[model samples]
Target: MTLRACGLIIFRKLHEVSAAAVGDNIEYLLLQTSYGTHHWTPPKGHVDPGEDDLQTALRETQEEAGLDASQFTILEGFKKELNYTVKGKPKTVIYWLAKMKDNSAEIRLSSEHQAFRWLALNEACKLAGYKDMQTTFREAQQFLCSQA
Candidate 1:
């Protein structure tokens, strides 16, 4: 059976693209798993018993990235789902678009992850390390651009 997971694609707006001023520019938040493969991705994990997908997304985002739905605005009409195999087992991930209102929102990590990054589109795709995840990043960028 395929595993199901859900998460948020959190981003902030930036003035310029300098590495030193990333926080000042819009960046996407991706976390590096402390577990197998040390893969970097948006805050996501297996869904829990009887939980709705959005609730699961919110919960995982909080647990993995320390941001709650209340702290960010979840853009309406935008959600991305990715399907792929991890360890040769079918897996599916659902991602919702969100923007951290404060931009400087503090992030607290759980044991599931050892590191985190706020990356631009290209950088994020490279760190994602999975074809399915890379496509998700592209779709997300298109969705955000359409909103403007």
Candidate 2:
């Protein structure tokens, strides 16, 4: 069976900028897991039995990043699904784009993560490790840029 997970690509605009320039102001959130390869990724976890994909995304974001649904505005048009193998099992991760409603909100990490960073597109992609994850960040950046 394929393992399924959901998450949000949470981003924040650092300062006022014109629509054409907004891309530079945006920063994406990434977390470094405390276990295994210690790879960095967005807040995500396995989907609960009865929870819908979006619900799981929201819950996992809260549990892993300490950011509740109310703290970010979900972008209506952006979502991505990545497929890969983990421990010899196929895993699928779904990610939705969200803009931070309040950039000042503190990021509180759970025990599952050792560190978190809000980074610009280039830095984020560099720390993301895997090619699939790097592509996801690129897609998210494109989506945000298109909206500007």
**Candidate 1 residues 1-148, lDDT tens each?**
9999988988887653555544335579999999888989898878999998999999999898888888999889988888878789998888898988887789999999999988988899999988878888888787766555
- Per-residue lDDT of candidate 2, residues 1-148 (tens digit): 9999999999999998898887799999999999998999999999999999999999999999999999999999889999999999999999999999999999999999999999999999999989999999999988888988
Worst 10 residues of 2 by lDDT: 15-24
Which residue pairs in candidate 2 collide?
none
Best by lDDT: 2
**Per-model TM values vs. the true structure:** 0.88, 0.97
**In TM-score terms, which candidate is top?**
2
Off by over 4 Å in 1: 15-25
- Prediction RMSDs, each to the true structure: 3.9, 0.7
lDDT (Cα) of model 2: 0.95
